[model samples]
Target chain A: MADFLSAYSIQNWLESCPQGYLEDTSYGHAVGEGEPGLLMDNEVLRNDAIRTTVQLVLGERCALAASSGLINAAPDEASKRFLATQTLDEARHVEVFTQRLYDLGVAKDDLESVLSTHANPHLVAFADVLLEKVDKKDFVAGVVGQNIVLEGMAFSVFEMMHAVNSEMNPKFCHVLSGTIADERRHVGFGENRIGSLIKEYPERKAEVEQMQKEMSYHMLATFAAAFQDVEAINELEKIGEERSHAKFQGADLGVMDPDEMEHLLADTVLGEFKTRLGRIGLEYQTPVAP
Target chain B: MIDDVHELRTDEFLAEVHSFEFWFQSIEGYLSDSTWGHDADAEEEAIDDEDRDRLISVLCNYCVGEAAALEAASGMIQIAPDRHSQIFLATQVADEGRHLEVFLHRLAELGVTDADAEIAKRASPSLLVFKDRLLELVSGKDWESALFAQNVVLESLEFVVFRRHAAEADTITSQVLEGVIKDERRHMGFGENELGRRLSRSPKLQQRLRDFRPELDALVLATLKETAHHLELDAEEERVLGKGYLESVERLGLLG
Candidate 1:
């Protein structure tokens, strides 16, 4: 009898869970179209959330790409076990963010549309990349294509958001903090995997470098535009303007001019590579913007 | 521990990147010695500080990759029970370990202390999948069929990626790839040649090829599509790469 009750609990709770309400706020849970139940109602984080979600979705994308690259190479059982774990980690990430939104109140209807939105063109391309139809049939090469280029940039943006949230935004701090930890862990997997992949395929080294350089241009520009959003900017200032909202706005929450943001993003990535190179006294001249 | 990675994350991820820089340079130093026309030995020898240790650390990471690869290949040997198949698989494992040696030498020459954690963290899941696929192939009752499928379908696709990276890699960044590519090229040739030879001896291999076509095509399509989209290189680049690579494979009579 107790086991039966426990088994039925999850379904019962889910059925009764009020579908629409934003963190118990009257903000309509989401000002979204059609259904209002989707929890990632916040414009910025929804976009961020979806982008992060795409990274997980794209993990299998790497598996497909990796198979293409393994043509001549063979891996053993222990390595296979590692792959299995990696697959699980990626799948876990996708679910975590999806549930995070659903838990907060995201509607299933909004989720689909949001995924298809202009905010996520890269994700679609990633799907195409993993399917190997766009241009390259090589999946290992595609791992960096989706993982490094698309998700890598998204990770950087998330890293920035993590910094801002940690330094400010006390209300959402706990959840955001946990998310940040996960994102950082995901990033570790990414950076190490990508660096090693490129190392394994040196001849295509030029190709990987070229792709990264191009993606850098697109990624930085996207963030600059996002930061310059008029409505978000107004909201940001409002936080600083009102005492109650002041906690969400602070030293880390200050405005960054587009030019400065662009330069800063590039500088940060370059600095990272520079430091990696510096350990062994090797240096690289990063591709400069025209 | 990812403590190092975590610490690096705090300064707005600059620290994490700086850590990346350390590894990148070590890889450079490791590979640079092989292509050396001029000796920087005197300068390097004079540096008794952390720099020496840095070199060793990079090489150890290389060793981790080798150990992991061998472990994976050993899994393949276990699955591939036939004497002939086992010999081939064993050689591949030996090749992987030798490839690992290059980096190991680079590390000992440098002064790396602890690369186990970092290297373990870095090894891609994609690499490990090979072992799983190998085990499944070998464990199946059809030993020759498994070998043929692995060689023709799997190794051929991997060659496409390895060849592309080797051709396009920039100097310093290409170090690790340079060492691995040579071994991969030979491995690919063996797979292709062996698969073809096995087929000539047995028309029984026909059923497997026909059955594999759709699956391989799907894999190829998914692999190509995702790579192009992810890399942001566009369809044109993918086609060019495909055509260029196919020509070479055709020349080798592997694709015909």
Candidate 2:
């Protein structure tokens, strides 16, 4: 009601989106090239070898990644309602993203292959370190881990994506915007309740932060490893263009060197992570700025 | 088949509650100022620094106490349905009642009786946000919906909102947080866990988050703004608060 979203923030986010730019083929669309566009034309999609492998992965797991059928195990009523809403939200998300993957030439599994390249292994430690194997006291712990911790941070970034990339292409704009609305609420549910818990329990702050770091660090590996591959790197660059990261605009990303795009994405992501952590009085070691 | 309860508007509800909140604030104003006209002779000696500190803690702790019960009830309601949800919500109301009693007793023990009439009378920045949250919940009808409205929304925000003040507060504040935190944890756990589970079941249920995210974020940010004002925090302090809030959400895996 009172300039809530901050005019500059909302406007700038919407203004910088890269919705229609993924089709650019300049600079060979190679992964490491400094060009801000991706080479997503017939040349890139023509390769059948990698395309087959991609198809297999997508077919096996097309379901939205979330905890949907867990209501009976809910520890309480309010929680049950919240989960009900969240499951509905994810189902919609899966539907929307599945559609988006179809529109893209990469196919679902191909998309997964592209995405899988960024997979990180540290998710286990984060989940295991803080939560016990059996949380019989209330509900299963993994849902809590996935929905709240992972999705929470993810909501903001996705909103960031929708805000930054929606303008690039009409189709992407639709998917990004529609998908984002769902994530925003999903993330909100996780944040609002959890916020109260931490405020209520100051001491728990330490453990929560520790667990978050482990999870985020593992997630980082997903991004970090993929950035090295030519195809993955190219896809990321294309995503940057497709998503139209504001920094990729015109001749430069406003960074001193074009080579710094990798650092820019990497550092910016991590920095936001730490700042998010600090908002709740939880402390965590931020990766040293590159 | 479900009719959206969020469709309920707050004009009627807020009209009723805002007056109470205003009354509370007017009384709080007296304490904040140096008027101290209430029955001083009863507990004059103890009302010194330590007494004042303890009293503040107790009052806030009372808030913390109420918050705890409300949270538990919320978690219960979110996870259950029909009769059980109703039962949990009712019990939660009772828990809130007890907390009110304890808070009032603590205030009286501190020789602070007059504040009650003014306590909810005039809205402070903090009260306004809290009041908004409360009215929103009730307006939604059925405490199950309200539980989500209150515990998941208001109470959860209050935990962080109150904590900032408690962090620098006297014994009562810390004590309040200590007591409240235990209950609050389970409350949030229930909401998050239940939501996750339901999402696992049907597509319709999982989407509640996406639909509600904007409203929730706006509400949260508004609440944060109100708390920031009440705490008299500057930009840096606000950023610190934001950092803490985001970090807290992040840690809980609440944010994605």
Candidate 3:
């Protein structure tokens, strides 16, 4: 069987995933940042920032779920089978994140409204372009957009979240860890399949490279929109400092500014994207210099 | 234990049909079979060079249809609402892919290396129309209409064509068609069972299906007429094949 057709490997990965990632709520109590009644008590401004972050995550996952529907238009059997498993994986991610928002004091009634109202416009636009590629049955373009670009950006955000929250919110950290693992597998499948497609039709190499260039611009725009508010940066910095203090016992670790951290995250993600594209026989130029 | 009539059935149909394994083994076995050329001799003796070329054209046309079917099956996997249905559609994807491979291989054996391009250049007009309509159906949000268009109308016509050709085909071609027909029966069974359950729950859906039947009928007949003209069949042969196709459709009760 082709590697793409071997969904049993993904099934094994899902089965062997560590517990507490999907349905554990006990760790929420361990993190004592806010009162349990933060949502009911209208005094917690930090909860607002948390709700916005959750809404951003929710929007990305929902876009992923919608894009999975277009994977059925792939031309080959192996690709179709592999993407079927991916569709289910994306749906599960949506469910996990939606439930996580509910557990984090975002009321169920407010979840969808928050997501629709607060999602970054650039990120949404980026997702729409990727989905439109799939709708047009441009298979290579879709794979590059969703798996390489969107998922790569997502992997970076999840890594940053996991690193910051591991000390403060272990429950949320666990969820991020599981999601990161799934995203890695998704990126691997994309690289492998896109490699094969490029090998078969060498002309697609230029098209894919152009797509990567366009997606990089969208990624920058998304990051800029996300960090435009200085208040949001201050909130994130406070959370980072609190978590760092909890993890390191009064050690004088020099603080990295939020703007520096954002740049580092974007660079790390784009670096990985470029390396993967090169490995798959497509050359990608950095759209924005580091 | 009493059974609920409304309960969805979940049989191990994939295992029973030996979906992938059967096609894989049959194709590998047939491609290397030693008696492959025996049928070629029989065919060459039975038909002159002109008739032989026409028969090859017909075979190439079927190959194109199989390729289109493969695309439709792949698209259905995304829209299927339930796990069982999705799994079944995935198998159909594999089935159609296998059918295309085997047909192309057979065409190659008949010394037609560029069969796909040749047939595309002179593709039957009606088949192209039918394919366009089928793609439109599958691409729409209504999964039931896609199922009805594919398995009931298109596959039913395919079943008739395969059966007709199996009677007059060379030995190896007949053997391949045998396996293909068996798979088609399973696919048709799935479409019937699923569509029946859906229509039972929604009177509105049933009415919609009733209204959509004639359009499907016209497409099927148009394709059949093209096939007859391509093969230069007599008027009697065309009427008999047309009647057989309608009987197959009526048996499925799709029109009602």
The C-alpha RMSD of each candidate to the native structure, in angstroms, is 21.9, 19.7, 11.1
Off by over 4 Å in 1: A1-76, A122-155, A167-201, A238-251, A273-290, B1-256
lDDT score at residue A236, model 1, on the 0-100 scale: 43
| Tens-digit lDDT track of model 3 for B15-111 | 2232222232333333333222223343433556776677677777787677667667667765777534654565566456556655765676667
- Mind sharing the TM-score for model 1? 0.38
The lDDT for every candidate, in the order shown, is: 0.42, 0.42, 0.63
Tell me how far candidate 3 lies from the true structure as C-alpha RMSD in angstroms. 11.1
Window of ten residues with lowest summed lDDT in model 1 chain A: A13-22
Q: Which prediction has more favorable TM-score, 1 or 2?
A: 1
Fraction of native contacts, model 2:
0.00
Residue ranges of candidate 2 with Cα displaced over 4 Å: A1-40, A43-75, A105-148, A159-168, A199-203, A230-259, A266-281, A285-290, B1-256
For model 3, report DockQ.
0.06
Interface RMSD of each: 20.3, 18.7, 12.5
For candidate 2, give the lDDT of residue A78. 45
In model 3, what is the error at residue B127, expressed in angstroms?
16
TM-score of chain B of 1: 0.53
Model 2 residue B141 CA deviation (Å) reads 36
Query: Residue A239 in model 3: shift from native, Å?
Result: 11
